[model samples]
Target: MKLETIDQVAVIGSGTMGSQIAMVCAIAGYRVVLNDIEESSLEKAKESLEGHMERWIKKERLTEQQVAEAFGRIVYSTFLNDLKDSDLVIEAVVEKLDVKRDIFEKLDQLLPEHAILATNSSTIVSSKIADATFRPVKVCNIHFFNPALVMELVEVVQGPHTSDETAQTAFQFVESIGKLPVLLKKEISGFVANRILGKLMDEALFLYENGYASHEEIDLVVTKALKHPIGPFALMDLTGLDVNYYVRQQRYEESGNEADRPAKTVEEKVNKGELGRKTGKGFYSYT
Candidate 1:
C-alpha cells in the first residue's frame, strides 16, 4: 500500500489523551474530528483543548490569532457513523482490549480500504486489537505520551499482520506532527516506557508496604536527593491512582505475575473515588 498523507484525522474518545492528540493534529494543520459517545465528554474535551490553547497564548508560545486558527481546524462529534470521511482514525479510549476491538471493528467497517487505523493504547498489544479488525494490515499503535503536544516521543507499534508501508506511513505522519517516533518491530508487554515505569513503581510500593518510610518522606528523599521531578507517590497522584492501577493491571495480566499487581492502598483509594490532585486528594492533600 502506498503511504497517503493524512488529511482528516479522527480521535475517538475525548478524554485527556484523545483531546490533546486532536489538538496536536489541528495545530499541525490536519483537520481533526474528536469523536466521543457523550455530549458531556465532548464538552469536557473542548474545554480542555481551549484551556490548553489559552495557556499557550498566556505563555506567549502562540499568538492569539494562531491559537484561533488552530482551534478552527478541529470539530467534535458524538457519532461513530461520522468517521466515514477520516483518512486516519485513532482510538484513544480506555485501555481495554474488548472496547478497543469493538471500536476497531466498527472503524474497519466505517473507513475506506486505504484509510489507516491506529490506537493510542499505552499497554495492550497492537496485535490483540488488530485481530478484531478486517483490515488488520492497517491497524497499528501510535501511542503518545500523557501530554501529546509537549511530549516528543510517540511509540509506533506494529502488529504481526501490519504492512510495512502502513507502519511507515504512521511513523512519518507522527513525525510530521512534530513528534519523535519509536518503531517497535513486534509486540511487547507494556511496550517500553510503561515497563520501566511499572518496575520502579513496584519497588516503591514494596518499600512503602514494608514500612521502609512514610509517603511524604519517601517522596522527599526521591525528589530532593535523586532530583526526580516528583516522587513515586506524587507521580501516582498526578496520574490518578486509578489510571496507574489500570496500566499495572494490564501488565500483570499479560505477565501472569502477582508482583506486577497494583498496590493495595492505591486500589482501595481508587475504589473510594479518592483519585488524585485533580480531586484535590491522593497520597498528599492539595489544600
Candidate 2:
C-alpha cells in the first residue's frame, strides 16, 4: 500500500474530533466514510461539516466548488462493514481501552490486510489495543488535537509492534493532508502535548481545590500573564468536562494513583450533564 494508493479513508465515530477528521480527509481529496453507531450522530456530523464548510467559504479559506467537492467525498454509515474498502481507518471513539479494542478487532477482520489502523486517542497508546488485531505492525496512533480541522500539529506514534513502514506511511499521510506531523519514537501514555498540558491542568486544579485561588482568577492569570489564548477552565469547557473526567478516570484506573483521579469540580459537572459548550454549560454557563 503506497501513499499514492491510499485514497479511501474511514473515520469511525461522528463526534467532534471524528467529524472534523473526516472533513479534513475529504478536503484533502480522499473519499472518506464517517461511521457511527447511531443515525442521529451521523446527521449531527453532517450538519457540523456543512457549517464548517460554510464558514470556511465565508472566510475565503475554501471556495464553493472546493466545499462542494469535499462534501461530495464523504459517506456516512452506521455499519463497520461499510469500511471494507478503506485503505486507512482512523478510530476516534471514546477513550475506553475495551471499546477501542473491540472496534479494532472488528476492523481487522473486515478491512483488507494492507489497510492501516490508527487511533485518535490522546492518552491511550496504540500498544494497548494493537494485540486485539493480528496485524499489530499496521496499528499505530495518529493523535489529532481537538478541532482537528483547525489544529496544525498531529502526533504519529509508533507502538512496540508498529513497523517502520507503518510509521513512515502514517507520517506521510498526515503531511499530505497539510498538517505538521511529529513522530513519537516510543508509545507513551499521554504522548507529548497532553503530558505537558496534563501537568498544567493538574496544578491548576490543585490550586483551585486547595483554595489558593479562584478558578476564574487562575484562568485570568494564565491568559493575561502566561499569554495563553484560553484559561484551563475555559479549555476544559471547550474540551468537555465529561471528556476530562473520563480520561482522568482511565489514567487513574491504569496507574492507581490518587492524583490521577478526576478533579471534584469536573466530576460534579459531568455528573450534572454540564459537559461543556456542546451541552451549553460547564465551569461557566454558555446558555
Which candidate ranks first by lDDT, i.e. highest? 2
- lDDT tens readout by residue for model 2, 1-287: 56887989999999999999999999999999999999999999899889988989999999999999999999999999899999999999988899999999999999999999999999899999999999999999999998899999999999989999999999999999999999998989889999999999999999998999998999999999999988999999988888899899999999999989999988988899999898998878896
- State the lDDT of candidate 1 residue by residue for 1-287, as single tens digits: 44455788999988778999999999888998999999999998898788888888999998899889888988889988888989898898876678888988888888888899998887887788887878888888899987687889999998898899888999999888889999998977678987887777777877888999888888888899989877889988876787787877777887888877878988988888888876789988887
TM-score of candidate 1 to 2 decimals: 0.94
Q: Return the TM-score for each candidate structure.
A: 0.94, 0.98
Instruction: Name the weakest run of 10 consecutive residues (lDDT summed) in model 2.
Output: 1-10
Candidate 1 colliding pairs: none
lDDT scores of the candidates, listed in order: 0.85, 0.94
Clash totals for all models, in order?
A: 0, 0
